[model samples]
Target: MNHTDHLLIFEPEMAGHQPLYIRLLYHYLLENKPTLKVTFVVHPDINKRLVKEDGIKLQTVGNKINLVFLNETEISASLHNTLWIRAVNRWRLMKKYLKTTGANHGHFLYFDHIQFPLALRLPFLPEKKISGLLFQPPMLDFYGDEKNLKEVIRNYRKKWFYTLMLNNTALSFVYTLNPLFPSYARKHFTNGNKAYHLPDPSMFPTGDINLSDEDCALTKHVGENRKLFLLFGALTKRKGIFEVMEALKHLEPEYISQIAVVFAGKLEAGIRSTFLDKVDFYKQNNPNANLHVEDRFLSTNEIISLLQYCDIVLAPYHRYFVGSSGVLLWAVGAKKPVLTSNYGLLGYQVQKYHLGISIDTTKPKLIADAFRRYLNNPDDYERNTSGMERLHAESLPENFARIFFSKFL
Candidate 1:
């Protein structure tokens, strides 16, 4: 009930995929009817960068949430190290913090499965509750495609270790954004000490923003006359970047000329060369088909601007488990129709609500056809966007917080 009730959130990385959801959770807890105290145990790399003078600001939405950043060492010594070493290192760092904190009767929220082994090892304060928040699996099935046989074997071994770590957690809370992984999670947490299917926080919005004079000018400059199709988030192999590129290849040159694909976020090393090569080929072959790639990290406002101006959003993940996506949520908040792959729970939700079209990413023809349909039936796309907005309004962070707190706290 008190703000000092102590909720520790352990995460390996806070910047990219994790922070948005964590921020939503932080605000929700703070804004709850009976406020719950929360402390975020962030990775050292994230904390160092975020706590800097020009770092991310931690402000509660309604003065209901309080954020304390506890820094932990990175999972790897170097950026391009093996994931196994990183997982082990992250667990060690988190374990060190948990042992020193000495908090009693509070809650421990593990954001990733890699933190679970260390969390379970901690000597918790008597009556303390431990809850695991699983965003996705430790290793994705498609990741193996990007590696050699030996490397794939090594990855799977590490994945097995991570799976065991997850099994040892007190309660596993899966954020089901993709519908495909629920059964996998259910099977993993079969004993069921505590396991709940919580929707991803992307389903909720912070609130509407009124454009200022300068903001209007910038929006008009960046987006005016541009039929934007946004693919926000890290450009990686599993993200289905190649699939989207292939889809674009199938589009008629004239039809493609009318649209622009805007990609925002950092590029992953695994597929960087291949992705860039494809992008280069497309640019050379089709000068009229505009492909705007922002190689740098984007701030929140810039992302919001893209969401606002974009006619359609693309979430073409090739192989993914059902979990929430910040991009999808942002599109919903911005009232933009999404064209996503029918691979996970996100696709299920989109189809269920008629909020967007789900295509088979494996088939370039289907992906191109989906886009053609959207272009031809602009009214249908608008209707889908409106439906997404309504769905988002119904699943506000406050409402979702109630569900999370009721189940965990």
Candidate 2:
């Protein structure tokens, strides 16, 4: 192996949702196969931050990895103007970058969903060896309580463009987190020659964080004897934060006293009002109860510490379209018992692996009862921990490296 073949990872923005997985993938590739040159093709806005803060650099990792910061002229032209227009312009810019890069480099792997506007615009470029890796299907619809016609139409349009782009790919790999997504992708794309099913990378544990005793100390003052049920993710309605708060209201006072709920994540702008309203209502109704909400992002060490102390992890997600979540992966990595809803692939994994208890998001009592069951039965909690440990051991970095190399590398 000459170690000169390059992998080009294209992501518009390197913040929120996808970056975590991308970071994991970057490290996995570098550590597992040191010879291959990995070049991250990010938009100008993302490149600086990803390099400085996110630590996505070749030399930093003590390897000869390359990070190419391709300036997106089209995105810069339409940003702060209109999203639809911006997407169109971004597609043009991305196509230009791909064409120039592809001509210079003989072979490259694109680590993005098949539907990015740029992928659709790829017809303009000369044919070259390009592999498309799908983390999530672009056309998958997210169903929730919000029923605005305009929003619905916007989502459908976005999906339509994605479908077109994915169908035209040279080589494609669908990383299905849920069974439903793969079937949906296969049917919609209908490109058997290019597509294959790949599992979500989140299932593979990266590594264990070395947390000091002081670092693991609870954010809120914990009395000598107390139990805590923690929920950590973006505090949005779709994430079931409101439902969790409602469930807490019905719990008995004694149980409430023994329990504390810690919410750690940034709240989405649209749902900030709803989130605050629920928090206010909960506090007004139960003055003595402990409800700790950390509204900012936490460092990896902080997150690991919080996970270590959690009695039970709560992931009462309302949407079924999303296949896997980094939050759930973290809980599994930390060996904490999770109380997640029967949503999509995550629910399937929970049931199949016996990782934790699953509840219906519609029923608040189910969530409360599930929490109580784990709180009351120490043996059940222990059993769940054992299962999580086994799962973790089987799906760590080394195991994931083997799978990736065997299939793709």
Global CA lDDT computed for model 2: 0.59
Q: Which residue segments of model 2 deviate by more than 4 Å?
A: 1-4, 28-36, 43-64, 70-90, 102-122, 129-166, 169-171, 178-190, 202-209, 376-386, 398-409
Per-model TM against the reference: 0.74, 0.74
Cα lDDT of model 2 by residue, 287-346, tens digit: 878887777655556677788777778888874344466677778887777788665565
lDDT of each: 0.59, 0.59
| Per-structure clash totals for the candidates | 11, 0
Model 2 pairs in collision:
none
